[model samples]
Target: MTSLPPQEFTSVARAEAPLDENRGFACHVLIIGGGASGTLMALHLLNASPDMRVTVIEKSALLGCGIAYSTTDPGHLLNTRVHNMSAYPDRPEHFRDWLRQSGMAPGATDESFVGRQIYGRYLNDLIARERDLPEVSRLRCVKDECLRLEETPKAVIAHLGDGTCIRGDRAILATGHAVPVQSHAVLTSGWDFTPPADPGQPVVIIGTGLSMIDHLITLLRNGHRGTITCVSRRGLLPQVHTETKPLAISRGHVPLGAPVSAILHWMRGLAADAERQGGTWRDAVDGIRAHVSAIWRAWPEAERRRFLRHAASFWEVHRHRVPPDSARWLQEARDRGQLRILRGRFEEATMGEDGLIAVRIRTSGGERVLPAGRAVDCRGIRRDPAKDSAPVIQDLLARGQSRLDPLKLGIDTNEWAQVLLADGRPSRRLFAIGPCARGAAWEITAIPDIRVQCAELARHLHAIEAQDPVGVSRG
Candidate 1:
């Protein structure tokens, strides 16, 4: 587990070896995005094949944090319990063990929710440890944004922002999510925040989901005693998690051919029956989660769209539950009259004089005008790859090398996550994981689910690499 010589960690331009010819380069895999998915993928691949070469290109200088875990605000806490936050399923206590070994409290078993920055540090430390592995000597990480990707006869060429290109036999797009979108008027008017404004001034948050919660925490931590308003169509906050009993429902018991509405009706009835038998609905939901993927697969595209349009928000709020502490804090904030949650549609927004923004919101009661000192858009990432602004994704789309999913969930792919082309054919050497594969597999975002996918994908990549013995040079 010795460190590679400093020279070997130099920039791509100054590396000892020159870029391979357009003919092709022999490498195990080239992974894009050094966030959780990409880093874990690299670790899995390296662990499977010590002789294989793996390179991770990260847009941000920091690796492993990605968008969800990158916040520095102490108030931005993880919503899940520490015990269940392990990056690997097989290692159920991995995160808890790491916490203890790092000199934190021992035998801490409460559903404790810690700061997001602390979680980021844990992820970074894990990556550092993995990099020290003897097998990881074959792993190379590049700190550059990928601008374009082209699949050649022999290899895939990844063009970086710095105008340099690298080729690999296989490529993986773990690009993760994009930044939240802001209103066009806000951008054009150059309405940016200068903190420490009057505490009583009003502020509007664009989305009432988890991101909005983060903004609320930030505003409070900044000592802003202002009236904070979070507006969304459904005006739903994340559901709070609670201890529950287990159920006897198995995957085979759930009918697959029924319409989604019918399924929901059946599920509701089952939950009611469970409640009559002295069990909570939480038990039923947990039972359904065990076979959610199967249910999702059984649904037709129309049914899926119906669910998205009618029930996605409700599902999200329940599926992504909040930790008890954060839930209490939010409740307290509301009870104190400092925070307001409005359910409505965004009508329009205008800039006013003296650092003020007027937002017109439309609710069932009618239009209401609210003045805000500052506005923050926290709607979360755009999931449609066709509308994505990332250069690498755009390049692939232009060349017909990759196609967007029918539902625009992200890129099109098979169950194995092999990226499909315009002609609806899966590429042998190009695979995708994480949020990018949502179209192919609905439930792939959570760490536990993603780790399993990475493990399985790693096995596939390793089998392929074994057949082709590509020798990677070590420093």
Candidate 2:
């Protein structure tokens, strides 16, 4: 129920100059995608030095509310606890303090799992504060999709879908996760769902992950009394967070630069040790958070693929935990026979004469037929952006402005998050962060990791601008 500060945004003007390499650009920073990552990067840039100007272009009608926090459902709670949800890592208690100050939670606790919408509001407020600063700092938000980018030595010209082109000295591709992919019987992804006409009609949920829980909670709250079947390859659900002090990794225990199997073995040993010491495995998982990026980077190409293929599922289930309340709700649903979890692969789907959906699944033993009035795919976010329908991304790849990672999980970027061209050359004017930069930093999606990236990137840009202010000239 807390009210957020009013956002004051100015319109960004398209460059009037012709698309010539001789032209100079006016904008200092060009951020594509006004999601959480882009917003934070802008904030960091302005805060580091007030002399910079930023323009954020987003396809969404709304800014700040990316796919993660765009949900209006109260049931969609933040997976991370309130204390650890701060936008800035330096101010660790920033989010919790804001909750209390805003009167959203008079006395917020560390374990509080607030609605994700509230976090989105916090982001909007944070960005607004940064934008309100005095002279030498200007931030504009453009509501349009960036279709293509033409990078020259002097500047980067971003072409918008509406025939508007803007030029900036540097561009950061903060485009978040791609549109979720549809699976066998499911036609779409995420929390979008329409309840069947019959409240008692059965439902099948493909992939038992966070998305599945979101759909399940929504259905149950909407008075659904039918059986719910969740099907996945391993039927693995995220572990629940418990109230325990997280412990750091003991010295020399976490194996860095090791193979996937060795890393998994090390983690298991650490988890067991933590359990023996009256701490939970969650603590052990949290301990490894700081090193995951390095570990992934240290891994050889084969080891990286090995981790993705053999250990990703188990690691994800343990690392990204659900709220305790959600876990209990799921347990209760299963105990009452209202929910069922099965390990299987989706083979095919058909429409039955009874107007039901018949799904053929390949289980451990044999094939089985499951019928449901409706189905939803909760298989998680689409890691590969090349598989998406984003015109801008397609254009980038087609023009060789950007290339896919070796693993094809995301765009190719170097260690510093600079986007690499198809020819394996890093672009001085192009950078990437968040999910798109996952290829560079395997753990770059979360707030803790992204905030660091923003700080570093802002510093790097500031240094570059200081060295040659007239280098990226605006004529």
Candidate 3:
């Protein structure tokens, strides 16, 4: 068997094939988001079934550039390498191959860390090519927002903001990472960066994670000479992506359903052992990425909460890493006394009599007030999705159609990506994938996990339709 890149798959290689659409329901799938998740779902559905139609409605103009990949910065390289960033799980080298064929990165290799903007272009081109294909005629890309969704006995109707209602056999919630709006920090948009009126004035950023790094890079690129202060609870920065030797971790090696404490001990021991073998702790961290979801699901609610409270931050810093160049630049900024990280949590911000902004932080010493000319909330992905989810998600929750996860990470869903209702019934009509299903699978937020989830859910829907045609709207 051919060896897959580190982030592509788990222990063993398995074969996948499209189901016989001749025996399946020739239905339509309405996806609310047209980012990577939605595009991947549509592709898989079209490939797996012959007659199924997929209409992808994205509020943004682009098809596959979600909040994460929409950035146009050349300096912002993908955290993961080319080999692991493919939109297809089975086609491990698809992205690498695309890079070479498209001349986007003619010399790109499996280890090449290409610019995110180029990757965004790659996704856009990928979907664009698919849509133009006669075989993929079932794929429809709509530029609109689904404001409300209504499920009928025979169909699902999506009401768009433009006064257009789309009726399909089934609806999917692929709306990725919705950051709850209102930022008292005054700088809400991470991707859209406007040069500060006074570049020399001190700037305060709210989080010390990847988002923070993104803003920092933008600031430096734009020649901002001001001192930057990044605030977070522990002020932990993400590690940098590095070359990793394969670590063969068997499925049985993971302590499934065990206490979070035991899991933590195992990870520490694993990292220690890897270091002893001349490999970095990163080997141990990357080794467990595929199994985190299973371990997350196996834990009791109490144990899950305990992990979140105690070890989640450390895990995240090691797990979700930055590009090597970004890490090096960050180090240089720190060395020059231009960037400093504050160990505290952002509480409030207020406008002073002067034009400056006073940002308040709750620290161990006491409540400290930091005055700055500008402030931004780089709080990263773990935002309050319950309050600021998509318009359709909010409507669903208000109408008791769907419920939030116990931890409020995102909407609650079952293992098969079926949306769980308030009454705890699985929603055969509505399904969620990608970040929205983070509560169900913690790793689904990344491309590797998301591609697999999309593939599985597409197969699952086809299989279900084969048994019972008419699919979700049969009610």
- The per-prediction CA RMSD against the true structure, in angstroms, equals 5.6, 4.0, 6.9
lDDT by residue (tens digit), candidate 3, 1-475: 1211223211111221221122233787889898878878887888788768777888877777787777757777788988899988888799999889977788999998888777766777777776777543566677778999888767788898988788777888999887767666455555556668899999998889888888898889889999999999999999988888756788898899989889998999999989999999999988888889999999988998999899988998999899788998899999999999999978888878888889999999999999888888777665788777898998999999999899988989988788888999887788999997788877788888888888898888888887776554332
- Cα displacement (angstroms), candidate 2, residue 214, comes to 0.9
Candidates 1 and 2: which is better by lDDT? 2
* Number of backbone-clashing residue pairs for each candidate, in the order shown: 0, 0, 0
Displacement of residue 382 (Cα, Å) in model 3 is: 4.5
Instruction: Give TM-scores for every candidate, taking all chains together and pairing residue i with residue i.
Output: 0.88, 0.91, 0.92
Candidate 3: regions farther than 4 A off: 1-25, 134-136, 183-187, 472-475
Query: Which candidate leads in lDDT?
Result: 3
lDDT of 1 by residue, 1-475 (tens): 1212223222322132344432232354789888878877877777666555777888776778787766656667777778767777677787887777764435545456666666666667666666555542566667789988877767787898889988887889998875433544652111123343677788888778887777776677678888888889889999877886657787778988678788889788878977998987777776676666677778889988888888778778877777776777778889999899999887777888867888888999999887887777666667446665467777788889888887888888877778888899787678889887777777777776688889888877666564654321110
Write down the lDDT of every candidate, Cα atoms only.
0.72, 0.78, 0.81
Candidate 2: Cα lDDT at 109: 84
Question: Candidate 3, overall lDDT?
Answer: 0.81
Clashing pairs in 2: none
